[model samples]
Target: EGKKSLNFIEQIIEEDLQKDYKKEDLKFRFPPEPNGYLHIGHASSICLNFGLGERYDAPVNLRFDDTNPTKEEQEYVDAIKRDVEWLGFKWAKECYASDYFQQLYDWAVEMIKNGDAYVDSQTSEEIAEQKGTPTKPGIESPYRNRSVEENLDLFEKMKNGDTPERGHVLRAKIDMTAANMLMRDPVMYRCLHKNHHRTGDNWKIYPMYDWAHGQSDFIEQVSHSFCTLEFLPHRELYNWFIEKVSKPGDFEPKQREFARRNLSHTIVSKRKLLQLVEKGYVDSWDDPRMPTISGLRRRGYTPESIRKFADSIGVGKRENLIDVSHLEFCAREDLNKIAPRVMGVLDPVKLVITNYPEGEEEWLDAENNPEDESAGSRKVPFSRELYIEREDFKESANRKFFRLTLGKEVRLKNAYIIKGEDVVKDDEGKITEIHCTYDPKSKSGSGTEESLRKVKGTLHWVSVKHAIEAEIRLYDRLFTEETPDGVKDKEYLDFVNPESLKIVTGYLEPSLKDSKEQDKVQFQRIGYFCVDRDSTSAKPVFNRTVTLRDSWAK
Candidate 1:
């Protein structure tokens, strides 16, 4: 095998391996707060951690940082697990921060006894005010000098629910004058008198994220705790808590930072996504227009496509907006090799063969996927009357137009060559049906000389008698702006594209009647689509994944 170039995160690991870290000591983790569905941004991190595990033959843990009960839920936890597993990686252990709450509480008590932590009686706002600015020293809390006995008693009261929810909080006794604001006596625990998803109502006080994260990593003996660059400042505090909890010569985890890759036209913030849901901008978390993993899945994006996207973008020291087309390109590249080609006319206009027998129909052999011969072929029904895209025809078109028009011959895919003769219109002058005549000798794939006749266009169509109707959902970008949240004075929701979703009934070839939920297909001349989970025997529904090519390209 060739020596592969390493990403910066891998280089950090290599540097560690050269130092005191052994290959056996390599352990990584993907810790996500279970508050919402995992988005495309999280995919990069998941791939990074799990990719590292695969590269080093180490174990990766799936740990839910479910420290906040007010926002976190078991549904989100289960969704995180499902999304991770769907991305084709397995965790060595399924862990949660709440699992070590008792251990963290014990450590806090020990820190109080050693004067390393003190219970503050001020409200959270007061504590924040005292944190001060980076250039100025923070004011010390009035309860900074509380006795160990009194601190322990108050901490117990906070834990026992005897204190009001905002009454007392435990703060690490760090330097108040530290330049790093996070180091200025950061709150380690706060009172939250709410029922937890996992540990229902047994405790009142919960540990803060900074207090729980590094300690959980230490407890799990995670060798490298790689988080987003936002946590670079938290590294000092992460280590401080780890040092206070670990004894001399004990395992110490290293914290590293990586930049987040944001997708164009999409806001990766969970809070904003929740607003989109609550504001009725989207139907649900798994709405096909959403950027969430389940949403992508429902939109016919393959697991391999997502992983390829993550790896192609890779990790970096700086963040940038990745054009959503690149993601669509990845989906097209994968779906092309797998998704079967089917004919589904979204805007149907009738076409009649004037000479062909009206009562007769035939099943024609159609290649399932021209890109994959092993995918075999399927039978598509054809008859005298067919439905083609309403935009595929014109009474008179210039030289550049390749589709059907008066006196211009075109091939019916997998069937026969036909030429437009006349049109039947309604009282309102709308072209109701196009009348055409077929050359009987030009059946596709037949060994006749006429069958090989070159035509400027090949139109996909479904037999009028055999066509199945399906509810087709055409989706566009959810937001109009490339960076909806980046603009000043405008909420992301203000940029929501009102035309993101358009629903219509489509006429599909009979070969698609047997398609099950999640089955993907390239609807010839239209776009890629998938059978939605909501599809039933009587009412089939399909979601448009992406267009055949980048439509937004300039």
Candidate 2:
């Protein structure tokens, strides 16, 4: 039986509804910075915000927190939208912080004219020195007492590109000795004479993230502002700013924090991922081994599997590292019922069925996916010459070995049973091939008594004459450490997994000739795989997402 789907976020929404928080009044926003590609951590947030919208019958706005133009880009913005839509959620309206630049500027002016804010002349170093440690009270800035009229004029001048130095800043005139240090007169605006991606170079000033985030949510009428735990301290500052800026009875969006998802044995930091791409350590941002959403998609991960992972992890207040195996488990669960079973050999060893007639071929019926009865079956080519996994045969046999060994019997998947007669080796004593003889009466699904005989092992095989040659890329975790970002003293790069990706040539069943880019399937007894963007009609390329469960790990 399927288990119930429950997450802490859903429970919160449910209680809110029970307490008369009107369903139609609840609104959520997925506010991403768009400075980097979306990672698995962001997927959790995406599911929460959009899932709330779905449950409440409310709209979820997709807002880009494009506060820092230097780091943000149109490419990132487009990628984020693509990822969200792929995850099966639609944004009610597209929003950008740049769209409210004028309103934010007007609010800054109001603050300056009311003596609640002022233009500061302290350099960044001087400001830092004044902003003391948590154990100490901060010293007031020299310009803290500037007259309201003078401060307003200075703010306008600053906005008009009059200040080119860091000392000139517009700061909220909050307490400098507050216990919560974020309220110690945070900077509201900075003078940056840079071109904005959306607003262009019409103004030289930009609102700080702390100042713009809450008001933007207010302007959009968002009822809930969801963020990660790192922003908890800033929440107090956020609510304070919103209270002072908006009317008393107006709805102020509440800020709630949840512990961001962290996966074991994987580094999800954008900085580290960028380093891997720029330093040529990896192919690109979408490399199959990367943890980025685009990377996972390119690696053959389905959106359903990823969303299911987010739901399974649930929402929590405490932080913990989740095993990457849980993610693999979700993918396997999703693909088990969908992916068609196919035959492929990575390390091929030639097998010659001496008892079978030469230059003859037969069609053998193979179930497409035994897990799905409606999938039916397909015919596979079977012939005298076949290729099996190299590991399936042994010249020096062991007593417990169930695979093909000298004089041992084994069954070919979807074909007749065979017995290994002898093995062939080169001068270096490396086994090159195996000789076997087939029992015609033991063909699979032949409805004969011999066909029902049990064999210890069944191996997937491809006819040498009808097989398709292809390139396969196998990917592993990118990091060797459990917490690559936790150790401050050691560089994260030191934990890089050197064997993250391996590319090799392999042979697949002839049915794969029709496979195109992004098509996924399960290589029988091996793993689930996807056709890569690099696939060609002549030589298709595939990526192995994850391997099937085997007892080796046990």
Candidate 3:
């Protein structure tokens, strides 16, 4: 056995351990704002932190950076917890930024008294205008020189909701001419009168993410605060704020950046996803077409598949767009090993065996999953009349067509060899039924020589009388464009795939009737599918997880 190579993030930890870092001092945290459901993009961060926690046997806290009250909600907080737990990682503690509001406010007061922070009375627009670009230094607010007594009094009034929401903000008194724009007196707290989800109306002001994030990590003593690459510039401010609030000897949490993994043809932005839900583009946040963790779960994605994907891609220093096909490929691979094989025809065409007796039926032995020996077998009813895929049969086809064609032989999966003889069509020339003759001695799994005969194609079928009808929802990419967000001229919504979902009635084997919600199965030659939550005794519904192969490949 060989030791696994470390990713860049792991290498950083290893390097730190070799230097001033202690093995036991390694604590980590996954901080997410409870503004929306966790998306596929968050999956990487969750896996990385949780993976490191497992690697070092360190405590990893599930911390909510729930600073703003307007957008944050307890619903999203609960959803986030469910998502992380579903990924199979347990958090050491459930913490929230709201829990540290009082401490943070106290620290802000101390910073003000020390002249490291001040209350800025400028409107948000005016403040933004003062934040000079990359080459230019920002203009310091006139109030930046306010007396500590005046600043303290004004900030206290702001916290008490006595000021207008846009009137005042607490800013760190860092260098106004610093090269990093984020270091130029960034806002620490903003006066928001909205009620906090956890604190209720206890406090009327909220700390900015930049202010609360690093300090919360510092307070919890998290050794590494890993954030996406966009936060790279904020590391200075992150450290500075921690320095202001910490003693010289205290351990500080360092903010490190990793490139975000983007999925093609999908938007991970919560704003856009919210628009999708609000505009009726999707049913809800958990719509199967969405990339949210709940959406993927409802869409039949197994936790094992998602974790495998996150682990396989690892973490990268540079951002790259991953084709959704690879994710689908992962799902197919995982489902193949676990999903029970069943017969289903989404677009069925009736096939009547001419020589077989009309009322006769036999229960044949069918393997549940050939990939697993212990999966064993089940009885699948075979009858005179069966349904196969409409595309499987053609009155005539070229030599390349291995499926059922007139005068050609094809084996019915788990049944007998059948030769297409004739077809019955409507007056409009649409195929209504297909008639075939089966070799009785050619029953599959029988020791008879005819049963051992080879065929170019094998087609899955369900007995017409014993089959159960189901509603199948075939899912596709949400956006038609490869990079929906990259287009400058059009919005991501403009590229929404109109045919992303297609509902069809399917003929499924009788055994599937007993399948409960969330039960996954491979529909033999069709694809992988799971019983949706909408299933009932009268009508079972299935969601197509992914195609058996990538059909969209060029």
Candidate 4:
């Protein structure tokens, strides 16, 4: 039997199946801390964890490791769920670490009673000082060997709001002399009177992430815990907490780490992303220039393209900076097949057909999408007075220039061929209007012999009388440097591209007047654009998603 090749994680699952694990027992989870909006880096993780569940026919839980009350919020929780669903994956259950507060507390008490944990009354700075580097053994805390009864009393006091915030902390009674600095009696819980987003102010002490993460997975009976490479060091602490709480015959959730996908020229750290938002470096988390999931969606990125990009990158053990172009390429590839083509002149120049009849209009056939036959076609209105791209015309040019140069003929897209004769300029010698003569017999698809006549250039135009006015936002890369965050000496904001966004009014075909928000279309010779949510019936706004090609590479 032919079988698909498996990733390392898949291979691990298959190996587990051969040993004792049942296919029905295969449960996966994607646990994201609800501190900030999910970014493109998180999209990769979402796809991976959800993809594993689909491949194994298992249930995947959407768990929020909302341990810190100071940062976690319902807004972030809602955004995370929306992002996960937007990526086209459904979780089996939406769980939160705070939901298991009582159970986790009871387990912490059990560990204390078992003489495997103790209360340490030390400042965070003091504790950090005692936690020696990897090259040296950490010094044991002064209160490490307190009797179990006293430790329990202190922990209860800490939880009952009797202790000041940061007065004391509960530490796992692991080896302080252990070579792994994280294993050297790490803190399990801390005193924080802050109100939790979910649990409220019912308790004072909260379990640390290392303490809550694995236990929550165990409580849900998750079989496979997938995390990024940064959590690899914490995996030891994750298992240590799980080992103390697990009962015999219970399924212990296994932790496996994969490298995080780093998109070039952008920062994905939630803290840094929050900084970007708070500092007003970007418009918002959903700004098109941002690498956030909402930003991508607003910028015309489809779920299919993102999922395809994740698949293309695949699962790797070592982190690598992926070129942002690959993502753009995927978006372009997906959009090219479905996006309807429309004529929109960003920099409009009036073009008059000198010989054409005045006060006359005609509708010409134009395909909605040339790549898809079933997309069908639509009628685009044309007339003697039309608007073409300002750069599409020149008074005089070499033979190599195929556009609307003097005495040079060019085909009007879906219309008749025309020859430029004269141009009207302003006082400043700026070209204002161009005059051209159209070949009446050379109408496109007319089936007449003149229709077969080939021109060196073709131009897209919109009838002046019927054209719709639109605000076009041209977006470029957010950062000018290839790796803005990689530079150690400078701030990431220093590399922000000042001209990342350019706004201009454009003339579009009348068919686009009714375009609703998020409607994607190709602006003929321009680029792929998405109808902005700010659009209204009177005026429409469009965001340039990506250019016709790799404009940056050029």
* Ranking 2 against 3 by lDDT, winner: 3
Writing each residue's lDDT as its tens digit, candidate 4 over 261-374 gives 899988888999899899998889899999999999999899999999988898999999999999999999999998999899999999999999999998999988889999
After superposing candidate 2, which stretches have Cα over 4 Å from the reference?
A: 1-8, 18-20, 165-167, 550-554
Lowest-lDDT window of 10 residues in candidate 2? 545-554
- Per-residue alpha-carbon lDDT of model 3 for 405-478, expressed as tens digits? 99999999999999999999999999999999999999998989999999999999999999899999999999
Clashes of each: 0, 0, 0, 0
TM-score, model 1 to reference: 0.99
Could you tell me which residue pairs clash in candidate 1? none
Better of 1 and 2 by lDDT: 1
Error of 3 at 100 (Å): 0.4
Error of 2 at 236 (Å): 1.3
lDDT of each: 0.94, 0.88, 0.94, 0.92
Error of 1 at 189 (Å): 0.6
